[model samples]
Target: MHSIVFIGGGNMASCIIGGMIDQGFDPLTLGVSVPSEQSKERLSKAYNIAVTSNNNDAIANADIVVLAVKPQIMRNVVLALAPALPKNAVIVSVAAGITVESLQSWLGSPRAIIRAMPNTPSLVRTGATGLFANDQASQLQKATVSSIFEAVGYCCWVESEALINAVIAVSGSGPAYFFQILDIMQSVGQELGLPEREARKLASQTALGAAQMAINSDQSPSELRDQVTSPGGTTERALNTFRNEGLESIFRQAMNSALARAEEMSKDFSA
Candidate 1:
Protein backbone atom coordinates (compact mmCIF):
# COMPACT_ATOMS: atom_id res chain seq x y z
CA MET A 1 0.00 0.00 0.00
CA HIS A 2 1.23 3.51 -0.82
CA SER A 3 1.73 5.71 2.21
CA ILE A 4 -0.53 8.79 2.06
CA VAL A 5 -0.11 12.04 3.99
CA PHE A 6 -2.41 15.02 4.24
CA ILE A 7 -0.99 18.53 4.77
CA GLY A 8 -4.07 19.83 6.57
CA GLY A 9 -6.76 18.22 8.67
CA GLY A 10 -9.66 20.52 7.90
CA ASN A 11 -13.13 19.57 6.62
CA MET A 12 -12.20 18.59 3.04
CA ALA A 13 -9.20 16.66 4.25
CA SER A 14 -11.26 14.99 6.95
CA CYS A 15 -13.91 13.99 4.42
CA ILE A 16 -11.31 12.39 2.14
CA ILE A 17 -9.64 10.62 5.06
CA GLY A 18 -12.95 9.23 6.27
CA GLY A 19 -13.85 8.02 2.78
CA MET A 20 -10.49 6.29 2.33
CA ILE A 21 -10.76 4.45 5.65
CA ASP A 22 -14.35 3.37 4.92
CA GLN A 23 -13.09 1.91 1.64
CA GLY A 24 -10.62 -0.34 3.57
CA PHE A 25 -7.42 1.61 2.99
CA ASP A 26 -4.92 0.81 5.76
CA PRO A 27 -5.13 3.35 8.57
CA LEU A 28 -1.46 2.79 9.37
CA THR A 29 -0.51 4.06 5.91
CA LEU A 30 -2.23 7.38 6.48
CA GLY A 31 -0.74 10.43 8.17
CA VAL A 32 -1.78 14.05 8.66
CA SER A 33 0.09 17.27 9.44
CA VAL A 34 -1.69 20.27 10.89
CA PRO A 35 -0.75 23.52 12.67
CA SER A 36 -2.65 22.97 15.90
CA GLU A 37 -2.47 20.41 18.69
CA GLN A 38 -6.27 20.31 18.81
CA SER A 39 -6.46 19.28 15.15
CA LYS A 40 -3.61 16.82 15.54
CA GLU A 41 -5.24 15.12 18.46
CA ARG A 42 -8.62 15.02 16.82
CA LEU A 43 -7.35 13.38 13.62
CA SER A 44 -5.19 10.89 15.48
CA LYS A 45 -8.09 10.00 17.75
CA ALA A 46 -10.59 9.75 14.90
CA TYR A 47 -8.44 7.66 12.54
CA ASN A 48 -5.80 6.07 14.75
CA ILE A 49 -3.19 7.41 12.32
CA ALA A 50 -0.10 9.50 12.85
CA VAL A 51 -0.66 13.25 13.17
CA THR A 52 1.91 15.96 13.66
CA SER A 53 2.28 19.71 13.72
CA ASN A 54 5.45 19.29 11.68
CA ASN A 55 4.59 19.24 7.96
CA ASN A 56 7.94 17.92 6.75
CA ASP A 57 8.07 15.05 9.24
CA ALA A 58 4.62 13.76 8.28
CA ILE A 59 5.63 13.33 4.60
CA ALA A 60 9.09 11.87 5.17
CA ASN A 61 8.30 8.48 3.64
CA ALA A 62 5.03 9.23 1.91
CA ASP A 63 4.33 8.05 -1.64
CA ILE A 64 1.56 10.63 -1.97
CA VAL A 65 0.95 14.06 -0.44
CA VAL A 66 -2.42 15.77 -0.48
CA LEU A 67 -2.19 19.56 -0.13
CA ALA A 68 -5.39 20.53 1.59
CA VAL A 69 -4.36 23.87 3.01
CA LYS A 70 -5.99 27.17 2.08
CA PRO A 71 -4.79 28.71 -1.19
CA GLN A 72 -3.58 31.90 0.42
CA ILE A 73 -0.96 29.93 2.42
CA MET A 74 -0.23 27.23 -0.19
CA ARG A 75 2.86 28.68 -1.86
CA ASN A 76 4.74 29.32 1.38
CA VAL A 77 3.74 25.98 2.79
CA VAL A 78 4.78 24.09 -0.35
CA LEU A 79 8.15 25.86 -0.59
CA ALA A 80 8.84 24.94 3.02
CA LEU A 81 7.82 21.30 2.53
CA ALA A 82 9.38 20.68 -0.93
CA PRO A 83 12.89 19.77 0.22
CA ALA A 84 11.62 17.01 2.48
CA LEU A 85 9.39 15.26 -0.07
CA PRO A 86 10.30 11.77 -1.20
CA LYS A 87 11.77 11.83 -4.73
CA ASN A 88 8.91 9.88 -6.29
CA ALA A 89 6.05 11.22 -4.24
CA VAL A 90 2.99 12.53 -6.10
CA ILE A 91 1.35 15.77 -4.98
CA VAL A 92 -2.38 16.39 -5.37
CA SER A 93 -3.90 19.74 -4.39
CA VAL A 94 -7.52 20.56 -3.57
CA ALA A 95 -7.32 24.33 -3.32
CA ALA A 96 -9.39 26.10 -5.94
CA GLY A 97 -8.06 28.86 -8.23
CA ILE A 98 -4.49 27.52 -7.82
CA THR A 99 -3.09 26.22 -11.10
CA VAL A 100 -0.52 23.52 -11.89
CA GLU A 101 2.01 26.05 -13.14
CA SER A 102 2.05 27.84 -9.79
CA LEU A 103 2.54 24.54 -7.96
CA GLN A 104 5.44 23.49 -10.19
CA SER A 105 7.13 26.84 -9.84
CA TRP A 106 6.83 26.74 -6.06
CA LEU A 107 8.35 23.25 -5.82
CA GLY A 108 11.52 24.48 -7.65
CA SER A 109 12.01 21.09 -9.32
CA PRO A 110 10.22 18.53 -11.45
CA ARG A 111 7.34 16.87 -9.59
CA ALA A 112 4.21 14.93 -10.34
CA ILE A 113 1.35 17.28 -9.56
CA ILE A 114 -2.44 17.15 -9.90
CA ARG A 115 -5.17 19.78 -9.54
CA ALA A 116 -8.50 18.68 -8.12
CA MET A 117 -11.76 20.64 -8.04
CA PRO A 118 -14.36 19.32 -5.62
CA ASN A 119 -17.55 21.15 -4.64
CA THR A 120 -19.35 21.53 -1.30
CA PRO A 121 -21.25 18.27 -1.81
CA SER A 122 -18.03 16.34 -1.20
CA LEU A 123 -18.53 16.88 2.50
CA VAL A 124 -21.64 14.67 2.26
CA ARG A 125 -19.98 12.08 -0.07
CA THR A 126 -22.21 12.85 -3.05
CA GLY A 127 -19.71 15.14 -4.76
CA ALA A 128 -18.56 15.40 -8.35
CA THR A 129 -14.82 16.04 -8.76
CA GLY A 130 -12.78 17.10 -11.80
CA LEU A 131 -9.07 16.29 -12.07
CA PHE A 132 -6.10 17.32 -14.20
CA ALA A 133 -2.49 16.16 -13.95
CA ASN A 134 0.77 17.72 -15.08
CA ASP A 135 2.66 15.92 -17.88
CA GLN A 136 5.27 14.72 -15.39
CA ALA A 137 2.70 12.63 -13.50
CA SER A 138 2.80 8.92 -14.28
CA GLN A 139 -0.18 6.74 -15.13
CA LEU A 140 0.16 5.01 -11.78
CA GLN A 141 0.09 8.33 -9.98
CA LYS A 142 -2.99 9.39 -11.94
CA ALA A 143 -4.75 6.13 -11.07
CA THR A 144 -3.97 6.58 -7.39
CA VAL A 145 -5.36 10.12 -7.53
CA SER A 146 -8.56 8.93 -9.21
CA SER A 147 -9.08 6.24 -6.54
CA ILE A 148 -8.72 8.84 -3.80
CA PHE A 149 -11.52 11.08 -5.08
CA GLU A 150 -13.73 8.17 -6.18
CA ALA A 151 -13.81 6.95 -2.60
CA VAL A 152 -15.90 10.03 -1.88
CA GLY A 153 -18.10 10.28 -5.00
CA TYR A 154 -18.11 10.62 -8.80
CA CYS A 155 -14.87 11.81 -10.43
CA CYS A 156 -13.52 12.27 -13.95
CA TRP A 157 -10.34 13.46 -15.62
CA VAL A 158 -10.23 16.32 -18.12
CA GLU A 159 -8.04 16.29 -21.25
CA SER A 160 -6.87 19.86 -20.85
CA GLU A 161 -6.44 22.39 -18.08
CA ALA A 162 -8.94 24.68 -19.79
CA LEU A 163 -11.64 22.04 -19.41
CA ILE A 164 -11.08 22.26 -15.68
CA ASN A 165 -12.70 25.70 -16.01
CA ALA A 166 -15.65 24.07 -17.74
CA VAL A 167 -15.85 21.72 -14.78
CA ILE A 168 -15.95 24.78 -12.55
CA ALA A 169 -18.91 26.07 -14.54
CA VAL A 170 -20.66 22.71 -14.42
CA SER A 171 -20.33 20.52 -11.33
CA GLY A 172 -18.16 22.91 -9.29
CA SER A 173 -20.78 25.67 -9.27
CA GLY A 174 -23.74 23.50 -10.22
CA PRO A 175 -24.93 22.78 -6.68
CA ALA A 176 -25.72 26.43 -6.02
CA TYR A 177 -27.92 26.52 -9.12
CA PHE A 178 -30.00 23.63 -7.81
CA PHE A 179 -30.04 25.20 -4.37
CA GLN A 180 -31.44 28.40 -5.84
CA ILE A 181 -34.20 26.44 -7.50
CA LEU A 182 -35.05 24.65 -4.27
CA ASP A 183 -35.17 27.91 -2.35
CA ILE A 184 -37.57 29.49 -4.84
CA MET A 185 -39.68 26.36 -4.88
CA GLN A 186 -40.02 26.52 -1.12
CA SER A 187 -40.98 30.18 -1.25
CA VAL A 188 -43.61 29.63 -3.92
CA GLY A 189 -45.03 26.55 -2.16
CA GLN A 190 -45.53 28.59 1.04
CA GLU A 191 -47.24 31.33 -0.94
CA LEU A 192 -49.74 28.82 -2.40
CA GLY A 193 -51.58 28.46 0.95
CA LEU A 194 -49.40 25.55 2.25
CA PRO A 195 -47.94 25.71 5.76
CA GLU A 196 -44.27 26.82 5.77
CA ARG A 197 -42.88 23.65 7.35
CA GLU A 198 -44.84 21.38 5.04
CA ALA A 199 -43.87 23.50 2.04
CA ARG A 200 -40.21 23.14 2.94
CA LYS A 201 -40.50 19.40 3.37
CA LEU A 202 -42.36 19.04 0.10
CA ALA A 203 -39.78 21.02 -1.85
CA SER A 204 -36.78 19.21 -0.33
CA GLN A 205 -38.27 15.71 -0.57
CA THR A 206 -39.40 16.29 -4.14
CA ALA A 207 -35.92 17.50 -5.08
CA LEU A 208 -34.35 14.40 -3.55
CA GLY A 209 -36.89 12.06 -5.19
CA ALA A 210 -36.53 13.69 -8.59
CA ALA A 211 -32.74 13.48 -8.42
CA GLN A 212 -32.96 9.79 -7.57
CA MET A 213 -35.37 9.09 -10.39
CA ALA A 214 -33.09 10.85 -12.89
CA ILE A 215 -30.03 9.01 -11.65
CA ASN A 216 -31.66 5.57 -11.49
CA SER A 217 -33.61 5.67 -14.72
CA ASP A 218 -32.45 4.93 -18.25
CA GLN A 219 -34.43 7.79 -19.78
CA SER A 220 -32.76 11.11 -20.53
CA PRO A 221 -33.77 14.17 -18.52
CA SER A 222 -35.52 15.92 -21.40
CA GLU A 223 -37.39 12.70 -22.25
CA LEU A 224 -38.55 12.27 -18.67
CA ARG A 225 -39.54 15.93 -18.57
CA ASP A 226 -41.61 15.51 -21.71
CA GLN A 227 -43.42 12.59 -20.15
CA VAL A 228 -44.59 14.81 -17.28
CA THR A 229 -45.67 17.72 -19.52
CA SER A 230 -49.10 16.55 -20.66
CA PRO A 231 -51.07 18.44 -23.28
CA GLY A 232 -53.02 21.45 -21.84
CA GLY A 233 -51.92 20.56 -18.27
CA THR A 234 -50.84 22.68 -15.29
CA THR A 235 -47.22 21.48 -15.64
CA GLU A 236 -47.36 22.47 -19.29
CA ARG A 237 -48.48 25.99 -18.39
CA ALA A 238 -45.61 26.50 -15.96
CA LEU A 239 -43.05 25.10 -18.39
CA ASN A 240 -44.41 27.30 -21.18
CA THR A 241 -43.99 30.34 -18.99
CA PHE A 242 -40.38 29.36 -18.21
CA ARG A 243 -39.60 28.82 -21.90
CA ASN A 244 -41.27 32.06 -22.84
CA GLU A 245 -39.16 33.79 -20.22
CA GLY A 246 -35.97 32.33 -21.81
CA LEU A 247 -34.99 30.02 -18.94
CA GLU A 248 -32.36 28.14 -20.97
CA SER A 249 -30.84 31.40 -22.17
CA ILE A 250 -30.64 32.67 -18.62
CA PHE A 251 -28.84 29.52 -17.50
CA ARG A 252 -26.34 29.71 -20.36
CA GLN A 253 -25.38 33.28 -19.50
CA ALA A 254 -25.10 32.48 -15.78
CA MET A 255 -22.95 29.35 -16.21
CA ASN A 256 -20.68 31.11 -18.70
CA SER A 257 -20.27 33.92 -16.20
CA ALA A 258 -19.08 31.37 -13.65
CA LEU A 259 -16.62 30.00 -16.19
CA ALA A 260 -15.30 33.50 -16.91
CA ARG A 261 -14.80 34.17 -13.19
CA ALA A 262 -12.93 30.89 -12.80
CA GLU A 263 -10.62 31.74 -15.65
CA GLU A 264 -10.02 35.16 -14.13
CA MET A 265 -9.06 33.58 -10.78
CA SER A 266 -6.64 31.21 -12.47
CA LYS A 267 -5.03 34.16 -14.22
CA ASP A 268 -4.63 35.96 -10.89
CA PHE A 269 -2.59 33.01 -9.56
CA SER A 270 -0.74 32.40 -12.84
CA ALA A 271 2.40 34.30 -11.93
Candidate 2:
Protein backbone atom coordinates (compact mmCIF):
# COMPACT_ATOMS: atom_id res chain seq x y z
CA MET A 1 0.00 0.00 0.00
CA HIS A 2 1.24 3.45 -0.84
CA SER A 3 1.76 5.56 2.26
CA ILE A 4 -0.09 8.90 2.51
CA VAL A 5 0.57 11.57 5.10
CA PHE A 6 -1.21 14.84 5.78
CA ILE A 7 0.85 17.75 7.08
CA GLY A 8 -1.96 19.48 8.92
CA GLY A 9 -4.78 18.06 11.03
CA GLY A 10 -7.13 21.03 10.82
CA ASN A 11 -10.81 20.58 10.02
CA MET A 12 -10.17 20.22 6.28
CA ALA A 13 -7.48 17.64 6.80
CA SER A 14 -9.48 15.85 9.45
CA CYS A 15 -12.53 15.57 7.22
CA ILE A 16 -10.51 14.30 4.25
CA ILE A 17 -8.73 11.72 6.34
CA GLY A 18 -11.98 10.73 7.97
CA GLY A 19 -13.51 10.19 4.54
CA MET A 20 -10.50 8.14 3.50
CA ILE A 21 -10.84 5.85 6.48
CA ASP A 22 -14.58 5.51 5.87
CA GLN A 23 -13.75 4.41 2.33
CA GLY A 24 -11.85 1.41 3.77
CA PHE A 25 -8.34 2.78 3.42
CA ASP A 26 -6.02 1.12 5.89
CA PRO A 27 -5.28 3.39 8.82
CA LEU A 28 -1.77 1.98 8.99
CA THR A 29 -1.11 3.54 5.59
CA LEU A 30 -2.26 6.98 6.71
CA GLY A 31 -0.37 9.44 8.87
CA VAL A 32 -0.61 13.09 9.95
CA SER A 33 1.73 15.76 11.23
CA VAL A 34 0.04 18.38 13.35
CA PRO A 35 1.56 20.77 15.87
CA SER A 36 -1.36 20.88 18.28
CA GLU A 37 -1.30 18.13 20.86
CA GLN A 38 -5.07 18.22 21.05
CA SER A 39 -5.37 17.97 17.27
CA LYS A 40 -2.89 15.10 17.24
CA GLU A 41 -4.79 13.18 19.87
CA ARG A 42 -8.14 13.89 18.26
CA LEU A 43 -7.01 12.82 14.79
CA SER A 44 -5.30 9.67 16.03
CA LYS A 45 -8.40 8.68 17.95
CA ALA A 46 -10.77 9.71 15.18
CA TYR A 47 -9.09 7.76 12.37
CA ASN A 48 -6.78 5.33 14.17
CA ILE A 49 -3.97 6.72 12.03
CA ALA A 50 -0.45 7.69 13.02
CA VAL A 51 -0.11 11.28 14.20
CA THR A 52 2.78 13.40 15.41
CA SER A 53 3.93 16.98 15.74
CA ASN A 54 7.09 16.26 13.75
CA ASN A 55 6.31 17.16 10.16
CA ASN A 56 9.53 15.81 8.68
CA ASP A 57 9.30 12.49 10.44
CA ALA A 58 5.65 12.05 9.52
CA ILE A 59 6.37 12.43 5.78
CA ALA A 60 9.87 10.92 5.56
CA ASN A 61 8.72 7.77 3.81
CA ALA A 62 5.32 8.77 2.52
CA ASP A 63 4.43 8.24 -1.13
CA ILE A 64 1.86 11.03 -1.07
CA VAL A 65 2.10 14.01 1.31
CA VAL A 66 -0.96 16.21 1.55
CA LEU A 67 -0.17 19.78 2.57
CA ALA A 68 -3.33 20.72 4.37
CA VAL A 69 -1.93 23.70 6.23
CA LYS A 70 -3.13 27.28 5.85
CA PRO A 71 -1.77 29.15 2.84
CA GLN A 72 0.01 31.75 4.95
CA ILE A 73 2.23 29.12 6.58
CA MET A 74 2.53 26.81 3.59
CA ARG A 75 5.86 28.21 2.42
CA ASN A 76 7.56 27.72 5.77
CA VAL A 77 6.13 24.21 6.13
CA VAL A 78 7.26 23.23 2.65
CA LEU A 79 10.74 24.66 3.11
CA ALA A 80 11.22 22.73 6.34
CA LEU A 81 9.84 19.50 4.93
CA ALA A 82 11.70 19.77 1.64
CA PRO A 83 14.88 18.00 2.67
CA ALA A 84 13.02 15.14 4.34
CA LEU A 85 10.26 14.62 1.78
CA PRO A 86 10.63 11.43 -0.22
CA LYS A 87 12.25 12.19 -3.58
CA ASN A 88 9.29 10.99 -5.64
CA ALA A 89 6.43 11.62 -3.25
CA VAL A 90 3.57 13.53 -4.83
CA ILE A 91 2.65 16.69 -2.89
CA VAL A 92 -1.02 17.56 -2.72
CA SER A 93 -1.90 20.95 -1.25
CA VAL A 94 -5.52 21.23 -0.15
CA ALA A 95 -4.92 24.82 0.81
CA ALA A 96 -6.46 27.45 -1.46
CA GLY A 97 -4.84 30.28 -3.48
CA ILE A 98 -1.32 28.85 -3.59
CA THR A 99 -0.05 27.83 -6.99
CA VAL A 100 2.04 24.82 -8.05
CA GLU A 101 4.95 27.10 -8.99
CA SER A 102 5.15 28.64 -5.52
CA LEU A 103 5.16 25.21 -3.90
CA GLN A 104 7.91 23.90 -6.16
CA SER A 105 9.97 27.00 -5.51
CA TRP A 106 9.55 26.59 -1.78
CA LEU A 107 10.61 22.97 -2.02
CA GLY A 108 13.78 24.10 -3.85
CA SER A 109 13.44 20.93 -5.90
CA PRO A 110 11.47 19.75 -8.87
CA ARG A 111 8.51 17.96 -7.31
CA ALA A 112 5.19 16.75 -8.60
CA ILE A 113 2.78 19.17 -6.97
CA ILE A 114 -1.00 19.35 -7.07
CA ARG A 115 -3.27 22.20 -5.97
CA ALA A 116 -6.62 21.04 -4.60
CA MET A 117 -9.55 23.24 -3.58
CA PRO A 118 -12.00 21.28 -1.41
CA ASN A 119 -15.11 22.88 0.06
CA THR A 120 -16.14 22.67 3.73
CA PRO A 121 -18.90 20.19 2.88
CA SER A 122 -16.24 17.50 2.93
CA LEU A 123 -16.94 17.45 6.64
CA VAL A 124 -20.19 15.66 5.74
CA ARG A 125 -18.51 13.60 3.00
CA THR A 126 -20.32 15.70 0.40
CA GLY A 127 -17.55 18.13 -0.54
CA ALA A 128 -16.54 19.11 -4.05
CA THR A 129 -12.88 19.55 -4.97
CA GLY A 130 -11.08 21.07 -7.93
CA LEU A 131 -7.56 19.85 -8.70
CA PHE A 132 -4.72 21.09 -10.90
CA ALA A 133 -1.26 19.65 -11.42
CA ASN A 134 2.06 20.89 -12.65
CA ASP A 135 3.59 19.43 -15.80
CA GLN A 136 5.75 17.04 -13.78
CA ALA A 137 2.73 15.29 -12.31
CA SER A 138 1.95 11.97 -14.00
CA GLN A 139 -1.38 10.43 -14.95
CA LEU A 140 -1.08 7.84 -12.19
CA GLN A 141 -0.34 10.52 -9.63
CA LYS A 142 -3.36 12.51 -10.84
CA ALA A 143 -5.58 9.47 -10.53
CA THR A 144 -4.37 8.77 -6.99
CA VAL A 145 -5.04 12.36 -5.95
CA SER A 146 -8.49 12.22 -7.56
CA SER A 147 -9.39 9.11 -5.57
CA ILE A 148 -8.24 10.71 -2.34
CA PHE A 149 -10.45 13.78 -2.78
CA GLU A 150 -13.28 11.70 -4.28
CA ALA A 151 -13.40 9.81 -1.01
CA VAL A 152 -14.73 13.01 0.53
CA GLY A 153 -17.04 14.03 -2.33
CA TYR A 154 -17.10 14.80 -6.03
CA CYS A 155 -13.67 15.71 -7.44
CA CYS A 156 -12.73 16.98 -10.87
CA TRP A 157 -9.68 18.38 -12.65
CA VAL A 158 -9.19 21.52 -14.69
CA GLU A 159 -6.78 21.72 -17.64
CA SER A 160 -5.75 25.31 -16.99
CA GLU A 161 -4.65 26.52 -13.60
CA ALA A 162 -6.63 29.73 -14.24
CA LEU A 163 -9.76 27.63 -14.02
CA ILE A 164 -8.82 26.87 -10.43
CA ASN A 165 -9.87 30.44 -9.57
CA ALA A 166 -13.20 29.86 -11.31
CA VAL A 167 -13.57 26.70 -9.25
CA ILE A 168 -12.97 28.78 -6.14
CA ALA A 169 -15.85 31.07 -7.07
CA VAL A 170 -18.18 28.29 -8.24
CA SER A 171 -17.70 25.56 -5.64
CA GLY A 172 -15.21 26.68 -3.02
CA SER A 173 -17.31 29.68 -2.03
CA GLY A 174 -20.62 28.45 -3.44
CA PRO A 175 -21.78 26.91 -0.17
CA ALA A 176 -21.95 30.32 1.48
CA TYR A 177 -24.12 31.61 -1.34
CA PHE A 178 -26.58 28.77 -0.83
CA PHE A 179 -26.44 29.26 2.90
CA GLN A 180 -27.29 32.95 2.50
CA ILE A 181 -30.33 32.10 0.43
CA LEU A 182 -31.42 29.50 2.96
CA ASP A 183 -31.04 32.02 5.76
CA ILE A 184 -33.13 34.56 3.89
CA MET A 185 -35.83 31.98 3.11
CA GLN A 186 -35.96 30.83 6.71
CA SER A 187 -36.31 34.39 7.99
CA VAL A 188 -39.08 35.12 5.50
CA GLY A 189 -40.89 31.90 6.39
CA GLN A 190 -40.80 32.89 10.04
CA GLU A 191 -42.23 36.31 9.16
CA LEU A 192 -44.94 34.49 7.19
CA GLY A 193 -46.20 32.89 10.46
CA LEU A 194 -44.23 29.61 10.48
CA PRO A 195 -42.44 28.74 13.73
CA GLU A 196 -38.67 29.25 13.72
CA ARG A 197 -37.87 25.54 14.01
CA GLU A 198 -40.29 24.59 11.23
CA ALA A 199 -39.14 27.42 9.04
CA ARG A 200 -35.48 26.43 9.37
CA LYS A 201 -36.14 22.79 8.61
CA LEU A 202 -38.42 23.55 5.68
CA ALA A 203 -35.87 25.91 4.11
CA SER A 204 -32.98 23.49 4.60
CA GLN A 205 -34.93 20.49 3.36
CA THR A 206 -36.13 22.33 0.29
CA ALA A 207 -32.56 23.28 -0.58
CA LEU A 208 -31.41 19.70 -0.11
CA GLY A 209 -34.27 18.30 -2.22
CA ALA A 210 -33.69 20.87 -4.93
CA ALA A 211 -29.98 19.98 -5.02
CA GLN A 212 -30.76 16.28 -5.28
CA MET A 213 -33.17 16.89 -8.13
CA ALA A 214 -30.61 19.00 -9.98
CA ILE A 215 -28.13 16.20 -9.68
CA ASN A 216 -30.44 13.28 -10.53
CA SER A 217 -32.66 14.89 -13.13
CA ASP A 218 -31.76 14.58 -16.81
CA GLN A 219 -32.91 18.15 -17.47
CA SER A 220 -30.97 21.27 -16.49
CA PRO A 221 -31.91 23.40 -13.51
CA SER A 222 -33.41 25.99 -15.84
CA GLU A 223 -35.60 23.35 -17.40
CA LEU A 224 -36.65 22.00 -14.01
CA ARG A 225 -37.49 25.51 -12.82
CA ASP A 226 -39.56 26.21 -15.90
CA GLN A 227 -41.38 22.92 -15.51
CA VAL A 228 -42.37 23.85 -11.96
CA THR A 229 -43.48 27.39 -12.84
CA SER A 230 -46.90 27.69 -14.48
CA PRO A 231 -48.52 30.80 -15.89
CA GLY A 232 -49.40 33.26 -13.06
CA GLY A 233 -48.29 30.69 -10.49
CA THR A 234 -46.74 31.59 -7.16
CA THR A 235 -43.37 30.24 -8.28
CA GLU A 236 -43.42 32.33 -11.44
CA ARG A 237 -44.37 35.42 -9.50
CA ALA A 238 -41.52 34.96 -7.05
CA LEU A 239 -39.11 34.15 -9.85
CA ASN A 240 -40.24 37.22 -11.74
CA THR A 241 -39.59 39.35 -8.67
CA PHE A 242 -36.08 37.93 -8.38
CA ARG A 243 -35.42 38.55 -12.07
CA ASN A 244 -36.79 42.09 -11.87
CA GLU A 245 -34.51 42.74 -8.93
CA GLY A 246 -31.51 41.62 -11.07
CA LEU A 247 -30.70 38.54 -8.97
CA GLU A 248 -28.62 37.08 -11.80
CA SER A 249 -26.59 40.29 -12.04
CA ILE A 250 -26.06 40.29 -8.28
CA PHE A 251 -24.77 36.71 -8.35
CA ARG A 252 -22.50 37.42 -11.28
CA GLN A 253 -20.96 40.33 -9.39
CA ALA A 254 -20.54 38.28 -6.21
CA MET A 255 -18.92 35.33 -7.96
CA ASN A 256 -16.70 37.61 -9.93
CA SER A 257 -15.63 39.29 -6.72
CA ALA A 258 -14.78 35.90 -5.26
CA LEU A 259 -12.80 34.99 -8.35
CA ALA A 260 -10.85 38.25 -8.15
CA ARG A 261 -9.97 37.65 -4.52
CA ALA A 262 -8.76 34.17 -5.33
CA GLU A 263 -6.52 35.53 -8.04
CA GLU A 264 -5.29 38.22 -5.69
CA MET A 265 -4.44 35.63 -3.02
CA SER A 266 -2.49 33.57 -5.53
CA LYS A 267 -0.40 36.60 -6.38
CA ASP A 268 0.11 37.43 -2.73
CA PHE A 269 1.27 33.90 -1.94
CA SER A 270 3.45 33.75 -5.02
CA ALA A 271 5.41 36.71 -3.72
Identify the candidate with maximal lDDT: 2
TM-score, one value per model: 0.95, 0.98
lDDT tens digits, residue span 1-271, model 2: 3389999999898899889988988999999999989998898788888989999899888989999999999989999999998898999998778888888889998999888999999999999999999898999999989999999999999999899999999999999999999999999999999999999999999999999999899999999999999999999999999999999999999999999999999999993
Which RMSD values do the candidates have, in order? 1.5, 1.0
lDDT of each: 0.91, 0.92
Candidate 1: where is the Cα deviation over 4 Å?
none
- Candidate 1, residues 87-180, lDDT tens digits: the string is 9999999987888888888888989999999887888888899999989999999998899898888999999988889999999999999999
TM-score leader: 2
